[model samples]
Target: MPGFSPLELEALALSLRVALWSVLFSLPVGLFIAWLLARHEFFGKGALNAVVHLPLVLPPVVVGYLLLVLLGREGPLGQALYRLFGVSLPFTWQGAALAAAVMAFPLMVRAMRLSLENVDRRLEAAARTLGARPFDVFVTVTLPLTAPGILVGALLGFARSLGEFGATITFAANIPGETRTLPLALFSMTQTPGGETQALRLAALSVLLSLAALAVSEYTARRLRARIDG
Candidate 1:
């Protein structure tokens, strides 16, 4: 803490904030979409799946640009929200979180879909025969069984959000203590003269944070597996 500058601390805090919000907002939607992909066949299913995973294949900058086009003040959704609800997202922390969420969503969905696919359909059918509603079966059976995957997905999304750079910087414009997360902060430091020390500190912090997230995810996954097996 002694060597870590206030700016670095702010950036780290903002990154966590953005990542937390991104994961929280995206989790339910991720689970629902994953379930749909794993359990149902519908028109445009392939297209929907492709779109959900598009961010992984597309450049981050392109994703950011698309977000800007769809969410900028003059953009359709942005304009409607502003006119009806007086809300704006561009260049704000919320926009940063949205960008991070878009980038992290595919990983979250993939993890959950795999877990859902592995769930025993017979159990669900038994629940249905026992008079459980679809929602009840999902809540009481499917969710509990797939909890590990959901946890892993959330952690993975959080980690990805923490390190998001191109999309966040593009959509949120790197405002200090607002939209400037750890990666953007490091980028800014590198551009400054004689800022290598602070940059190095931030770089190390990023690595530590990522490692911690991964460690927690692995530990949780193992515990969940053991519990399920037992």
Candidate 2:
């Protein structure tokens, strides 16, 4: 096997970092949005639902380009972030993760929304009758019941983020040891001479990671369901 350099290893680690951060940052937002969509009927709700799923239908490159415009150094939000917080997102690993998060958000929201829909409203009503606050009922009862779905959504999002390539490379420019992720590294290898073996290895790694994530998600869902039923 052709040995990888330190830079290659760094890219691999950075890829994992990007995926992890993306999952972490998006989870809460996904949950909130899922809850809103599942439990509320508000004006523009349909529009919001459509927008949430837009990334699924839009081309990945288009999503990346939009991010570049919205988060670029001179872009309004990006400029404000830079001036106010000394943060710049363009062409960075952080940008790649943001892109991944946006792309995977729909799946997360869908999974969580399904879980929310499955929750028994009667339990919430019972709690409310006992003088429990809305927030308390949500925190203690609704959230606990939806834990399995949340876990599944997170694992699914993580797997999707790990495989993100077109958008991440577009937004982050595939800088080795900085912005390049697993998929980006594999893509780079595919373009290099005599790197087919390395690309194959990276592909295998991606497959293994995906399988492991899926298995964990399934186990978590089963365990959570058993606990809820027990």
Candidate 3:
């Protein structure tokens, strides 16, 4: 904290804020999509799967650009929301969180999907055989089994969101104390003549934070495996 300047602190705070919101917003939707991919068969299911995983295949900049096209002030949804609620996202922190969420979604969905795939179908069947509704079966049996994976997915999403740059910058222009998250701040440092020192500091922080997230994820995954095994 002592070595971190005000700008670095601001960027770190913004990154955490954006990552948290992105993960929180993405969690339920990601779980539903993951469940669909892991369990159900339906028309266009393959297409839906592809679309859900598209962000992983596409360039972050392209994703960000598409978001800008669809959510910018002049865009249809953007215009409607602006007129109806007086809310705007472009070039704002919310926009940054949106960009982060979009970029991180594929990772979250994949993790949860894998978890759901590993769920014991027999357990769900037992729940249903006992006259439990499909919804109740899922809530009581599937979700509890999948909770660990959901947590890992959320952590993965948070880490991805924290590092998100191209999409965020493309959709929400970097402004210090606002859209300038850690990655953006580091990138900005590179462009500035005397900001190398600051860049190094931010880079170190980024590495540490990423490592911490990964450590927690790995530990949690181990616990999940142990529980299943026991």
Candidate 4:
């Protein structure tokens, strides 16, 4: 507690906010992509799957830089966004969230896709036979069956976002009260004399948070499976 300053707490809070928002923003997209990969056959399907997983293979810094180039103020998409909505991403916490989201997207998609694949197509057919529309079948059957996977993906994404360093720093910079997440704060502390204590504290906090997320994810998945079996 001695090492936990108000500033440090703020950084922790911001990191949590970014992680939460990133997972929220990416979850729906991940679900859609997962459903497509699990159930559909189309031209370029392989390519799209590869593209969805690209972030997992690419360098985090490279992903961050690409985001900057595409979503920065003068970049084409950035410019269009600014012209239309006056919203910007670079140098802000939201930008850091976006970077985290993009980097964690592959993991989210993979987990969801696996979950979707586990869903029984026969169950979906039964729903259709029972007069359920396509949308109704998906909403009531496919989604519930895949809930465990979605929860796992979201938790994984949150953990990944918390530890994100290169991508977040590159896109948002390590400014206090803005974009300085736990990792960034820890790194910053290492550079200053007598900052080791605070760094250690932040590191411990990061570990605890990650472990908590994993535990929750596992518990949730097991409970879901039990209910389904029941």
Candidate 5:
């Protein structure tokens, strides 16, 4: 085990911060999108689905550029936000988190959508037959059954956020102790002269974190599934 320098530790902390915030903010929206895809039928459904998944297929840098055009200081929305609330996102940790969230959104939504689609419609129907309202049915029946998927999606999104690089760097510019998350830090190490060892250390750290996240997600999902079954 290599001793982690203070800078390395900072990168790890920043990565965790960005990943957690990204997952936290994206969770409800991802679930809503998933539900809409699974249960709704309207005009432009196909287009909606394509757009929701565009990030997965598009180059991350391209996505980052689009975000910049939409949210940069000189961009229309960004300018309006700054004028209205003085909130700026460019070259900030919040910008990094937003970039990560956008990149991870497709994975989270897809996982949740599949889970929603797989839900036994009969169970929901039975709840309705038993005088349960739609909201009540969702709370008591649909949610518990879908909890595992939610967990999986959250953890997946978190892991993806941890590894986010191109979009974050483009949007947030990788400032030390602010937006320089682990992936960005690793990129820095690789680009700097005489930093190969540090790069390897960061790479190892990333692999460990990703594996741990996956393991926890699987174990927790199984526990939730057991409780639901019993």
Candidate 6:
């Protein structure tokens, strides 16, 4: 507890909050994209897939800069949003969440797509043959079968968001109690004289949180697999 001072605690809490928001905001979209990539072949599908995975290949700073250019107050989308809705995304906690979500989206989509691909098509077909509507079949059969993948994707996205530094800092800046997440806090501590101890503590906390997320994901996936196999 001593290692987690008030500031450190605040950073940790903000990291969790941002990461949770990132996952929540991206999950539905990620799932739909994954389903499209896995099940449907359409024009420009390859291009769409590449765009979804672009962040994985691009540098984090590049992604952050692009977000800033497109979502900044004076940027086109930003200006339209401000003019219509008075909503601003840059340099705020919500902006940080958006950055995190963008960075983590590829991982979530990949996991869900793999899961979707692995699902037996016959099960879905059988449901359809039994007079279930397409939406009902997907909701009852496809979604349940892909739940493990979705869970794994969510955990991966959460971990990625927690560790997101470059994009969040660039797009939202390291504003204390707003966008200063755990990684940003650790980075700040590293730059300050006599802050090595705090930096190490934050580093350890980050590792613990990431490990816990992975463990939970694995456990949930295994339980789901067992249930499915049984």
How does each model score on lDDT?
Answer: 0.93, 0.89, 0.91, 0.91, 0.93, 0.94
Listed in order, each prediction's TM-score against the native is 0.96, 0.95, 0.95, 0.96, 0.97, 0.97
lDDT of 1 by residue, 1-230 (tens): 36667888799899999999999999999999999999999999999999999999999999999999999999999999889988899999999999999999999999999999989999999999999999999999999899999999999899999989999988888899899899998999899999898888899999999999999889998998888863
lDDT of 2 by residue, 1-230 (tens): 36766756776688789989999999999999999999999999999999999999999999998888888898888899999999998788889889999999999999999999999999999999999999999999999999998998998899989989888877778888778888888888999999998888888777877888789789888988899974
The sequence of per-residue lDDT tens digits that candidate 5 reaches over residues 1-230 is 65889998999999999999999999999999999999999999899899989989999999899889989989998999899999999899999999999999999999999989988999999999999999999989998899998999999899999999888888889799999999899999999999999999999999999999999888999999899874
Please give the clash total of every predicted structure, in order: 0, 0, 0, 0, 0, 0
Error of 6 at 5 (Å): 0.8
lDDT of 4 by residue, 75-181 (tens): 99999999999999899999999999998899999999999998899999999999999999999998888888899999989998999999999989999999999
User: What residue pairs are clashing in model 3?
Assistant: none
How many clashes show up in model 6?
0
Query: Model 6 segments beyond 4 Å from truth?
Result: 1-3
Model 3 per-residue lDDT at 64: 92
Report the error of model 2 at residue 179, Å. Answer: 1.0
Error of 5 at 10 (Å): 0.6
Model 1 RMSD, rounded to 1 decimal: 1.2
Q: List the residue pairs that clash in candidate 2.
A: none
User: Which order, best to worst by lDDT?
Assistant: 6, 1, 5, 3, 4, 2
lDDT of 2: 0.89
Question: Worst 10-residue stretch by lDDT in candidate 1?
Answer: 1-10
Residue runs of model 2 more than 4 Å from their true location after superposition: 1-8
Q: Model 3, stretches more than 4 Å misplaced?
A: none
Give each prediction's root-mean-square deviation over alpha carbons: 1.2, 1.6, 1.5, 1.3, 1.1, 1.0
